[model samples]
Structures are given as structure tokens and as C-alpha cells.
Target chain A: MTDNMYIERSCRISENTIWLDGAPYWKGLPAASFIDFAKEAFRLLKVDYPKFYKMDNLSKLVFLAADFLLQQQDKDGIALVMANRSSSLDTDIKHQQSIQEKESFFPSPATFVYTLPNICEGELCIRHQLMTENIFLVDECFPTETIEMYAAYLLRSGKAKRVMCGWAELFQENYDAVLYLVGPNGEKEHTKKNIEDLFR
Target chain B: MVELKEELKGKIIEVLNLEDVTVGDIQDGDALFGDGLGLDSIDALELIVLLDKEYGIKLSDPKQGKAIFKSIETMAAYISENRTK
Candidate 1:
């Protein structure tokens, strides 16, 4: 039954550009930093959520990708299975720096809240009001096969009506986010090869 | 008190990362939380840390924040009264 699942849509953010469903959607400034790019993309997308401005870089990346994929679509009962390579190291370093110096030791709640990789997933859930099964994994690579298997299992087991799976990695200036929506119907089959092709 | 209010407004904007908000946007009587600036609990904690690090005022009681963080005016008044720095 899970084999019947298909890739409905995909969104990617990399190289200061945003791609939606295998097409270039937005191109940011050449020298824009990750935060700058995110803000620009958010504005270009006309996102009205004010909470978006307060998110850390990792959460912002994931939020932007999810925003592209999930906009104008039914958000109910959609599970999220995401993985990343950095595991929130970008914000972890900032939090560590905030406390490393005894003279300036002030760990902020905003920064402390995003030290875990799964916090990005939590941010997405908050933005979209998703109250379904969700998981965030940390791996050295994208773990394409694992994400496919897990998302397919969720659909086949009736755990979720739809699943959003992807990789969101951000450490320092480097950031990459690739998210795809999987459901019972779509033009592309939800196979490992098709997921890999979309990622590439 | 006017000078302190402006300073607190600037500090709040900087500490809370209110990118879309400016010092001019926040009025002296504007509510810091729901309905006005729309700051959440996390912003409240940031303001607490701001008070401690900048004004040397440690908020020992969490309930005090509800009243103290009501507006820029209230925060400045509290800081003026209790600031050890």
C-alpha cells in the first residue's frame, strides 16, 4: 500500500536560490548571507507570520522550505520526518559562545530553545499547527533511503494522511534545505530513486 | 524618565531581535505582550536578562514580570527604582 505513495511537491534552498518542484523559484543576492537570503525569501514569498523573524538560522531555513511546500495546501494530519547533518550546531555554537565568557555569560532563552536539531521541526509544527507524529534525525549524510522508508511506513500504517520529509542542514554560512510532500496521489512515484533525483 | 524609556525601548528591540520593530514604533504606553508589540514569553525572559545584564536588576519573582513588562513606561519605572547599577 505504501508503494502507492507519490511525491506531490518539492522545495529546495541552496546556493542562495530557491527551487520549487524542480524549477527555480527565487534567486537571492549573490553576496547575501544565509539570514539575509532567508529574510529576502520570506518577504518575496509574502509570508505574513511575524514569528518567522525570531527563528534561528536552522529553523528559518526549515521554515522557509516548509512554507513553500505546504502553502495553500491542507495542513491537517501531515507528519514530518526530517534529518540534518549539522544537528543545530550553528545555534549550538552561538549558545556556547554566549556562556563561554564569564564576563558576558548570558544564555538567552531564544537561543537556548533552538540548540537541538528537532527544534526546527518544532518550529514547523508551530507555524503550520501540525499535531501529528514527527521525528528529526541526525546523520552524516542525507539518509535518503531511511527517510523514504519511514515516510512510506507512516502512510501505509495509517499513522498519517500525508508526510513531509527532507534534509535541512545549516552550519555557519553553509545551508541546504530540501523538502518534499508525499501523499496517496501525485505525478511522480515516491521511490528512492525519484527522491534522489529530486534532491539532486 | 523619558531618556530611560527610550533607552529601554532600544534595548528591548535589540535584545529581543524585533527586526520589524523600531524604537519609534513602540510607544511609552504600548503593551509589550499580547495585542501591542506581540512579544511572547521568550521575549519576556530576554527582557529579564536585559535588566540583569544592563541595569543590574535581578527579577527574583516571575509574577513581577506581568506588571513590570506591561509597557516601556512600567519597565523604565521599575528599573529606575530597583537598578543597582
Candidate 2:
């Protein structure tokens, strides 16, 4: 049953750089804010999806990195398992600010929509048309073991032909995204330790 | 009418996140949903919010959206007659 299980590929996105398979994929400018840097990376990606601009910082980070990973890997029957630490706190704060001001109590529907971290997952599924089972977990740290088990369970139980798992966390300007696809065959082993090591 | 159409077009582009589209790209009579501009249900909701926020027009019923948002021509006419802002 484990014959085909392997980590097909991986991508990591930090504040100023993007890494794919442990190497520098794209490096952004130093002085620019993370949001601007993400926009630069999106422009570099040259993806035609116009909805990227409307997304919150978290979704944009995950969207940019997942765009690369999904392009490089098989997307069919792929379930998404995403985790984050802040869990949409940045957008929550922005949404709160929109309504909390008594002088201008106008609550923006646009900012209010992105108050959940799982909305990033929904954005990814919408962009790629991935109708597979998806879940978003939150913890103080990267729940490496939980993600590994969940992805592995889905693959082994035939719930999904493949699994895409990662951590995409964004708060204020600090952000990180590391997405990896697991399938029956690949260069990297789909073990818990290997997945954890990729982050280091 | 021409100025209002232009203003509506600009608002639609800004509100809907039609990044690739410009005011010049939209024709007054062109359909705003399905096939023409390809906006979905979420964009429709955003447009409803836009009508209220920018023009001070409140659409209490979702069904009213279909007629009001049919085209830039219709939207411009409605806004001209009803907009409080």
C-alpha cells in the first residue's frame, strides 16, 4: 500500500525569498514590505488569475506558493491540508478596525470576508478547481505530525489519490509558506521526519 | 449619461477586482454577468455592497440585483434616478 507513497515536490515561501526543493527559487527585494514583495512575486509568476489582488495577505502567500507547486506537480484528486499559527489574525485585525471606529462605523464586506484562515484554502480550491477534501488546522507551532498523519491517512485509505499539505502563516508583515505534494512516487520520501526537516 | 456610464465602468472595475479590465473595455450595453464579463455570485454580492456604499442605494432583496446589475446602461440609469450620494 505504501509502494507509491512519496513526496513529489515541495515549495517554501518566506518574507524575502521562495525556496523549491531546498534551493532558492525566487528572491524578492529587501526594503519592500512583505505585501509588496508578494505582489512582486505574483508578477514574476505571471499568472493570469486576476483574483490574486483581492485576496488577503495570507491567501496571497499561499496562492503564490501553491501556484508554483500545483504547476509542478499532479493536481488530480489532491486533497489540501493547510495549517497556520496566527489563523487569520492579520485580516481579523483589519476587519475589526473597519467597524470598531465609532466615527466611521462602516464595515467593509471585502475585508470582513477574509476573517477565516480556511478562506485561503477555499481560494486555492477555487483557483485550481480542486474539489477534494480539504482541512485547515491551527496551533501555536507547525503541526508537522498531525499534517503528516492526516495526509497519509487520506492517501492510504483511498480517500484521495494524493495529498497536498503545508503551513501558510501570515501576521502583519511576517509570513511563511511551505507546501508539498505527496503521491505514490517521488524523489523525496513522504515520512514525517523528512517533512519536518524541509522546514529547517 | 456618458459621464455616468464612464463613472459606473470605473466603479465596476475597482469594486469587482477586474484587474485586467479597464473602463474602455466595457461597453454600456454589455452584460455584466455570465459570458460577457464572467462575474460570479460573489462578484454580484460585492456589487450590491458597492451600490449601497458608493451610491447610497439599498437593495434589500437579492432578486432586485438581476435587473439593476444587468448592464452598465441599466446600472447608470438606476443610479442617476435613485442614488442619494
Candidate 3:
């Protein structure tokens, strides 16, 4: 039954470019920074969510990738299993810097809220109206095996109709995301080899 | 009063990262939260930090934010009276 799960769609964001289903979807300026790329991509996608402007960099990256992958699909009962290496280090550094100096210690709630990596998943749930199970893992690299196993379990256990799984890593100026949807219908089966190939 | 209102608007935009919103778009009487600017609780917290860092005003009670953050006009007025720096 686990083998019945298939890869419905895939989207990747890295090197200031977006790739969907193994084809280049959008490319930003070569010299643009990650923030520049995110902002430009948001405008290009015409996303109407205003909270996107306030999200930390990691959340923004995850939101963009998930938004791209989940488009035109029924979003009901979709669980999320996301992995990242940095684990919100980007915002943690900012928070640490703000509190390091006693004289200038002022940590805003906006920045403090994103210190946890899983807040990115929370943002996705809020945006997509998904009230299903979600898991966020910190790994040195993409945990393809773990994701596939967990996604299969969720699908087999009847916990979710579909599972959105992938890796979204952002530390400092470096960022990369590979998100794909898994469900009962698709041409490609959800396997370690296929997931790894899609990530690459 | 006018100068303080304008300054508060700029700081709000900068601190909240309202990239799509300009200071000119925020009216002095417009609500800062809910339907007007659509700001949420996180923006409220940022504004608290902004008041402390920039105006030397500390909000010890969270409930006070409801009145102080009602609008740019209220915020400017409160800062004018309470700001130590």
C-alpha cells in the first residue's frame, strides 16, 4: 500500500531560480541576493498574502516553494514533512545579536517568533488552511529516506490524503528548497531514488 | 504633532517590514491593526520594541498597547508626552 503513493508535483528554489517538474520556471538576476530573489519571486507569483512580508527568510523560502508546488491542487488533508539543515539559524543570529548587548537589548516579537524552524511549516498551514499533521526535522542534508518513510506512513495510516515533503534550508545568504507532493495519484512513484533525483 | 506622526509612520513601516506599504499610504487616523493596515500581534510586538529602542518608552503592561497602538495619531501623541529621549 505504501508503494501506491506517487509524486504528484515538485518545485525547487535555489541559486536565485525556480524549477518546476525538472524545467526552469523562473530565473532571477544572477547578482541578486536571496532577499532580492524572494521579493521578486513573490511579485512575479502575484501572491496576495501580506504576512509574507513579515516572515523570516527561511519561512519565506518554504512558503514560496510550497506555494509553487501546491498550486491548482486540492489542498485538503495534506500533511507536511519538511527538513532543513540550518534550523532557523538565520533568525537566531539576529535574535542573539539583538540581546547580546545589554545596553541595546531589544528583541522584537516578530523576530523572536521565528527562532524555531517549524514556524515555517506553521506559516504554510496558515496560508494553505491545512490542519493536518506536520513534522519538521533538522538534518545535515536532505533526509530522503526519512521523508519517504514518514510520508508513506501518513498516507497508509489514513492520517492524510496527501503529504507535502521536502527540504528547505536557509542559512545566511545560502538557501535551497525542494518540495514535492505525494498522493494516491501520479505518474511517478514515491521512492528514495526518485526523491533524490528530483532533489538534485 | 505632525512631525511626530510622520516619524512614527516611517518607523512602523521600517520595523514591520511593510514593503508594499509606504508612509504616505498610512493615514494618521487609520487603524494600525485589524481592517485598516491589517497588522497582527507580531507587528504590535515590533511596535513595542520600536517605542523602547527609539523613543525611550517602556511598556510594562501588554494591555496598554490597545490604546497606544490604536492609530498613528495616538502613538504620536503618546510618544510626545512620554518619550524620554
Candidate 4:
């Protein structure tokens, strides 16, 4: 790795809390439910993007983290590499419930659209008009080592100028996301240790 | 007519996820799509499902939705005329 390689920025969202760059960006938000908390966060951000209301809980958590982390920058060819434990399980349950009953079988298109975890990548790309390399990995835990290696490879190969990597896990009402922007120069090292430490 | 418009407004807000909007915010003549209420194509599909599920009014053609869903006034009129349930 080059000596100049580092993490440019980072953001985390969990429960009713939000943190940016290892500091509290927003706190004391409603802890009622993830849906309620996401709504409250969307309102607080004052963003006019109506599509946010259409996203599932997992996508909403990841989108909000990306919104806080990368909204200021004008970036292109950004690679998105994310991993999650739950892997869209919450949405899968909702989608199953929607089609389970024969008497009340109703498969909603909106809910079905979010069955895949990578839909968050599509949502983020849509929000920023970014058409770039993106992948979503479902693992038992935060796969920081895999992310670090992948991001470094993409950067070194010149496939990506920057990498937005993180862990966005959502199951039921519990959610945790830690997104880091990795580039040639920053304040934090773009290593597995630093990425895993940021999640805590 | 007034009651149907109010009901349509409530359903639109609920189904379309217009959390910040209220029935009072929507007027009878205001356009439901584009600039008036800022609804998109996905919302159009949800409204179609709402018609069949809630009122038993099935629309077979997508083009018919444009005229029927022009405004709350038109939607209430179409539902009142065609709803079987």
C-alpha cells in the first residue's frame, strides 16, 4: 500500500444515533422503531429526495450513512463495497408475509424490490447519479478484511479513484452501519484494523 | 362526493408514503402526479393496487390511469362510478 493511502471520511448510523468521523453528528433521536427513527432522520436532514421514503429499512440505513459521508464531494468512478450480517433478512420476512397467505396473498412490488441487499447500492447510485462498480457481501459479521483488500485492489488497479466501503446490517429494529471513504490521502489509515475499530 | 374525495386523499397519503402530507393539503383539483404532488410512476402502480384491493375497481389498461388519477376529484368520481365492493 502507498504511504498516502488513507480514509478520507466515515459515518455510522445505529438505532437512533448517528456518528460522523468518530464524532456524534446526531444523537437523542427517537428510539421507538427503526422505521420511525429513519423517518425522523430523513426529516432532520431536510433532503428533498422523495425516493428515500420508498426504501426498506436496511437500504434506508445505508443510504442515510452514505448521504452524510459523501454528499459534499463531487466524485466519480467510486467503488462501493459493503457487507452485512442480516443480508436483507428483515425485508425477506416482510416479503414472505406479504405472499404467505392464500386468502390474503398480496405481493407488493415495492417490498419485493428490496429483497436483495444490493438494492441499497442501486438506491445510493440513483441518489448521486453514480454508475460505478458496486457489490454487496453477506457474511456472518462485519467483513472488514475482505473490504480492505477489495478496496485497495480496486484503487491500485486504477479501476476506482475512491472507494466507499462499510458494513450496513439491519435486522428487525436493530441496525448498524459504518461507511468509510478511502482514497490516496486522509487522516485515518485504510486498513482492516481501522475499519473494524470504526464499527465499535 | 366530498366524502369520497376525503377518503381518496387519505388512501393516497397512506399508500404513497406521503408522511408529511395530509388530506387537507391536497385539493380536489390539484394534479396528483408531476409538479402538483410530486408523485412518481411507482406511486401510480400502488394506486392501481389500492383501487382493486380497496374498492374492487380493476383497471386493465395503464393508459386509463392517467385520466382517472388526474386529481382526487377524478379518482373519487371513477371509484364511485365503478367500484363493486
Candidate 5:
């Protein structure tokens, strides 16, 4: 049996700047509080949820995602699978700059540890305090088959009754995210396949 | 001095994106950080740049800025002392 589940809710965010090989122009987008940014992320997915702040970049994203899933899904044993291409280029650059500037320069532990693109899942799980299976993937494009494969594996394994598989793609400057919830009774109208079909 | 305070108020509003605060709202010694204008560390850095760029006074240590940046009176005093402009 597979243990993969599909998305129940989703969100996406995009900025006007091009993410060619580095971070966005910090001045391009309107200044946004962390909560406001999460709100906008959810707005892109056409979903709704509560907002809170005081988290660093990765933690903040995971916090909102877990919060959304908890409110909508009553089931436990959930998995969070996410995808991002360049990992955390923003923090990586910051770390390198610190090292290059001075002999005694110390790399920020916080920034260095979160440089992995997949750590976003662990951040979300830690926030939600979820001990379920977590996974991360890096891909060139947001492909449906990739997510569908992992999610199906989770459900069949019976390790998790539900899965929140999210596709978070960040190009040079463009970002798009889509999350799906799939489960045992997922064949119903509100299932992941149905939502994906609408997009098609 | 009053005109100087007024001019400083205008600059602060323009630079900080205070949005709703106005000259009338900011007393001469009213706190500019934390409880006053809700200015945080980032805003403090911006204000530091403002001092250097506009007044030609550079502050390498941000912690030192807390006291000197108390209000219009304090900021004006510091700028008046070190301002190359």
C-alpha cells in the first residue's frame, strides 16, 4: 500500500521582478509584514487562513502552511512534500558575503542551516509539531507527475492517512505554489484530482 | 529651532513611510522608536543612512544611535555636532 496523499488547499505568490540568478529586487515589491506576505501567498492559491508573524523567512512560510492544514483537515499522520529549485539562494548569498568581507567573519548559523530548499518542510512540521513523514524535491519545472508519485506512495504505505503535497516553484524571479490534499475518501468532490482537473 | 523641527518632521515622514503620522503628531521630544512611531531595527538603519546622507554624519554603531535618536531635539543636537553639511 502507498502512503501518499493529495492536496487539500493551495497557494501561490509572484513578484514583478525577474529572479534570473539571485534574489528579487528588495525594493520592487511593496513592503509587507510577514503576516501580510503569507496572506498574499494564500490569496494566490484562492485559499483562506489565519495569520501570525515573528518567524524568520522559512519558519514563517511553514507556519502558515501548517496552520492552514490543521484547520481544514481533522486527520493526523500527515506528510508535507515540497519542491524548490535553487534552495535558499537568498540566505546563501548573505552567508558568502559575510565570509568574504573579513577574516573573522562568521557565517550566520541560522542562515547557513536553512540554505537547503527542502528544509522548508521540516520547518512546517516543526511548527505544527507534526512527526509524520516529510520530504523535499528540487525540480526544473512544476510537474504534476512528480508530486502525484510521492503522494501516492505515502497514502498506500498507510503511514499517513492524509498528505499535503505542495508545489512551490521559484524561478529567477517568478514564484508559483500549488498545494493539494489527498486521502482515503479523496475520491469525493473536494478531492485533489477534482481541483487539479479544474485547473486543466 | 521650531522651523528646524518642522523640517525634520517632514523628512522623517518622507523617509520612514510613516503613512499616518504628521508634524502635529510628533512632539519635539516624543520617542521615535518602539512605543512612539513603532520604528524597529530596520527603520533605525534607514534613519542612520538619513543622517549620513543628508547631514554628512556617519554612525558605525547602531547601538549608539538609540540615545542620539530619541527625538527631534536629540537628533538635531547630534546632527548639529557631527554634521559635515
Candidate 6:
């Protein structure tokens, strides 16, 4: 009944944890203080966290998910459709708060870069060399059927033989990820409807 | 002095995420860039931050860091000369 689903490779969360370390539970989350928020994602995904260089928190999610998918996906070109309530609202707030007092205003180069939500997609494309369609939507929650339908259309139309489609959401400390490998259902007529019904 | 250089090597390997490098892997005058350790610009920026945080030196210009960071030897020399703390 609710179109509250999306695919995900990973969902990097805030260190402002509100629940146990394992289960996906939630409460209000404090604003992320530094790029350290990425450490949460890396710890969950079990990737060796890079020691230095400045890839802010948002880039961390995009880069890690992209790397994971690239290694595992057998595809041609990449088509991505992702949903978010709003793009980088927390980062935008922090950036504005920084420059509010010109004397103390330090536009934190790190925070400023993530003010646009689509940057995550761009970061992935750059990392994986994906040159294809990427659409970022702002929705209160994920739109499930539309997500699969669109991803299917791309695959069926031969735009991409395989698509890494899903929802990667980070709201406060709550995070959710569902990444799917969509194609012409091997051997059997593994209809797209079956794939779409996965959430059901 | 030798202890400091060795410490610097360990920090460099740790900070750059240089997965295949080690203290013995790094020689006193071994080149750190362009084929020796294969570090690039992003690694350079990390080293700049390291200079500020660990050695009390600030390198605002990336170009100026070339000779100063030619190797662990050059880095220690510059740090010994310019470090404020």
C-alpha cells in the first residue's frame, strides 16, 4: 500500500546513534560534526577506512557504495534513480550557520561541498567512470514501484544491460540501503514485477 | 634523529593508507612520489595536514612541498629547520 521502498548498496549513517549498533532502529539524530560521520558507514560495511586525505562524509557513502557495486555488478553503463527527503539539508544548515557570523564564519570547505545532494551521484560516477542517466528525487520517503519500473525501463531499453538501482538514505542516525541487480531475469522470464515485489 | 625519521615513516604509511608499504620498505632517501611509493596529489594534501598537526609546520603552497617532501630525509630536514614547536 505504501510506496515506501528503494534499493540500496549501502546507507551510511550518523554517529549520533539512537539505537543499538546492529538493528535498524531510530530516534532523532544530532547534526554531523565532521566528515567523521563516514566512519559509521565504513564500520558497518567493513571496508578498510582510508586513513587520510579529505573526502567529506557524503563522498564517503557515494564512494563506498559505488566501489562495492562496481566490483560486483556485471553491467554496461550505469543508470541510477535515488530518492531523498531533501538534498543535504543538514550540511546546508551547517554551512549557513558557519557564515552567519562573518568574524567567526569559517565556510568549512568540507561541509560546503556536500550542500548539494546530487554530489553523491557525481562522486560515484567519477569514481566508477559511469557515464549514463542519474536522477535524484526529493520525496518524504522512497517511491518503490516507480523506482523498479524506471530501472527496468532503462535495462529493457538496452540503455544499460544491468543497473545498480536502489535507495541510499541517511536521516539523522537512521540509515537504510537496498541495492538490486536488475536485468532480463536469467533463463526464466524473471519478470520485473517479481523484482518489484521483492519489498512486498 | 633516526628515531624521528622512522616514526615519520610509520606515520606516512599509516596516514596515506599505503597498504603495501612499511618502515623497512621506506629508505632514508627513497623517492616518495612518481613511482617509488606511488603517492599522488591527494596523499600530498594529507602530508601537508600531517606537517601542521604533527610537526608544527604549515605548508600553504603545494609546490613548495615538492623539495621539502622529496623523501623522508628531506621532510625531516625541513621539519627540523622550520618546526615552531
- The best candidate by DockQ is 3
Native contacts retained by candidate 1: 0.79
lDDT of 1 by residue, A1-200 (tens): 44689999999999899999999998999999998899999998786787888899999999999998887999988999999888989999999999998988889999999999999899988889999999999999889888998998899999899999999989999988999999988989998899999777
**Model 5: per-residue lDDT, tens digit, A96-154?**
88578664454444446656777667766655666898787777655457667767777
Predicted complexes: DockQ each:
0.83, 0.45, 0.88, 0.48, 0.05, 0.10
Instruction: Score residue A63 of candidate 4 by CA lDDT.
Output: 85
| Candidates' C-alpha lDDT | 0.91, 0.87, 0.92, 0.86, 0.60, 0.62
| Residues B1-85 of candidate 2: C-alpha lDDT, one tens digit per residue | 8998998899888877777899989999999998889887778888887887788898888898899999999999988999998
All candidates in order of lDDT, best leading: 3, 1, 2, 4, 6, 5
Distance from true location, Cα of A147 in model 1, Å = 1.2
Where is model 6 chain B poorest over a 10-residue stretch in terms of lDDT?
B13-22
Q: Output the worst ten-in-a-row residue range by lDDT, candidate 3 chain A.
A: A1-10
Q: What pairs collide in candidate 2?
A: A4-A184
Off by over 4 Å in 1: none
TM-score of each: 0.97, 0.90, 0.97, 0.93, 0.52, 0.59
Residue A88 lDDT in model 2?
Answer: 93
Best by lDDT: 3
Candidate 3 lDDT tens digits, A78-177: 9999998999999999999989999989987898999999999999999999999999999999988888999999999999999999999999889999
TM-score of chain B of each: 0.97, 0.95, 0.97, 0.97, 0.91, 0.93
Tens digits of per-residue lDDT, candidate 4, A1-200, equal: 35357999999998688998989988744646888788887888788887788888888999889988986786787889999988888999999998799967666767888899999999988887777788999999987778888898888888888889998988997889999899987778887778778977
Q: Flag regions of model 4 displaced more than 4 Å.
A: A1-3
Task: Write one digit per residue (lDDT tens) for candidate 5, span B1-85.
Answer: 6776788889888766564578899999889987786676656766776786677777988788989888988898777778897
Please give the C-alpha DockQ score of model 6: 0.10
Docking class of 4: acceptable
